[model samples]
Target: MTVSIWQSNLPPLREVDFLIVGAGLVGCTAAYFAAQAGRQVVITDALDVALGASSRNAGFMISSVDVYYHHAIAKYGHDVTREIWHLAKRSQALWYEFINRAGGTVKFQRTGSLLLAESEAEAEDLAQAADAMLADDLNIIHHKTDPLKRGYFAAIEQPDDGAVQPFELVHAIRQQSGVSVIPNNELYHITQHDDKFVTAYTRMFIFKARQVLLCTNAYSPRLHPYFINKVVPTRAQCLVTEPLVAPVLNTCGYSDYGYMYYRMTFDNRLLIGGGRKQNIALENDTTEDRVTDPVQQVLDNYLKRHFPDVTVPVSRRWAGIMGFTPDSLPLVGVLPDMPDVGFAVGFTGHGLSLGAGTAERAVNMMLHGTHPGALDAKRLEPAV
Candidate 1:
């Protein structure tokens, strides 16, 4: 994404109050919050709005990390896990508010979500997660047997989680935020000139801004060296079948330990994603947004094995890059050398669940110096 000398000298430098990089979900959400704070906000993106993973995701708004609840508590502690879950809940609430303001343009449903188990072992894990969630007084129902009768062994249903039209959702947020956007403009370099201003070099314009917040997610590493090892780009593949006569899945169904997920689109198309579990070497650490044969083949097998009723041809197939963090939590912090350049990236494939809330926290920290709690990047620093 480097800007060459030939492409760099088109426009004169401009000054902005607040500059946001990446116009996807997180970036737009950040713009929304920044504008609410009365800062003139501008968003710039390489591709246009919601063209990346934000719109390309399966659109499940599950209020948890990429892993099961108990596993999250095991990996990060109980308090941290609870706080992350609440963050996701807050994101969903914000999304609902935006959808309400969309005036029927955005399609969404509160159909809830089911975390299904593919095997006995996974079923046992679901039970454990259910116990942990119940102990925390979280509203979840555990079904000892598969409710979908789709060959799953067990399930955990989160009534609060739901499905969304991701592309429309982002556009709605952008429109509601009332922020001017410079589309198809990619940021190549950014630096803090002084405490009062940060300079950014982009494909279209050089911007000197009072503050900058990067919601670039997967592309953050390419924009700056600070995100190098902290935010690793990973690819996720998905496909959708031609419309079916009747609805097959009534709710968002997640399986294979949250790797594979499927749901019925608003138009009755069956959309399914996640085969990277078997093709990790091919899919990991790559930003290429193109689907490969191996991963798509696994998805095809999964569809046929569990959803034999779905015989329609695939309408479309696509891939999107996600930012994966080492600890499986989104990071909120400023660049070590550039203190005013704040960032909220590394959603680890759970952007829809965590983006809005993390964006709010990131905006507050950058403008009001509020601590981001569990999502603070200082948590990742090595202890002496």
Candidate 2:
């Protein structure tokens, strides 16, 4: 007999027009907007909600790009990159809008972010990128400032950018409009039919719906083979320091070409993360939720490099896996053969910044069969 993914855990799924897999920020946001539009939605996750990349981040809600403006302009051209940057800004705005509407205990800090440039040449590039953003009438402050103890060449001060408790936002979105969030109910597999999809869940529960959106992000490759070539799982290490006696990091900070980032939590704790580029081979791992000593050492010693005065015991350290794409953009449309199934993945570590807007775009595509150029089917077709 073939063993079932779940033993004696028979749960019933009901009246679900939209079955969304993965209860991270992407999946939860999908459920949020889908139900907000008066659609019956059921969302499932392998683990508890927000336990993935949704919560395991530095929690900067800045509209900054993973592929920064300079690099993006070079790779995808100026026009396409500008459109992508606007979409990223819109994604951050989605968080703020939901936080206001939720009217609950959501932790959102409007702490502006500083993108640092270490070298004079790099600073010039940053200045140009800032000019591009300013030309579009977006909020931007470009100047040479020694904000950090480690003297930087220049910085792009994004005033509208801020930080948010990503887990709270994910939870709040689900809580809105009675979306069914089946946590601890892992989706082991998905069977795509000609007209619909049948999902296999842990605890012997299954659901069929006209539309199924795979918002699983990193683990999306397991359910669909196409993602095996498109999306690659990458590990990100993060840590939180013991409460500081005085405020150390005032606003969200990024440096070294967006490869590293740090921020201050509400309780005067410093949360720092992002060092995958430091050790590409080791950080590319996604097998476990544990942090490697090499990356942890980088976080452990980063304080001395920037703020020598602030010293605190390490409170906690952990790691989470996120999906990456070859092009550093997300795949947010249906597969070529699977008409009834649509999906989104490969955020390239900018999931929080892009999840909500991309999820909303997925909903629009599913509903009206079209969407804005920023997140339409043609831009992110998995095959391409």
* Residue-wise C-alpha lDDT for candidate 1, range 207-305, written one tens digit per residue: 989899999999888988778888999999999999999999889968999889999999999999999999999999999989999999999999999
Which regions in candidate 2 have their CA more than 4 angstroms from the true location?
1-15, 196-202, 372-384
| lDDT of the candidates, in the order given | 0.92, 0.77
Q: List where candidate 1 sits over 4 angstroms from the true fold.
A: 1-10
List all candidate RMSDs to the true structure: 1.6, 2.9
lDDT of 2 at 321: 85
Clash number by candidate, in order: 0, 1
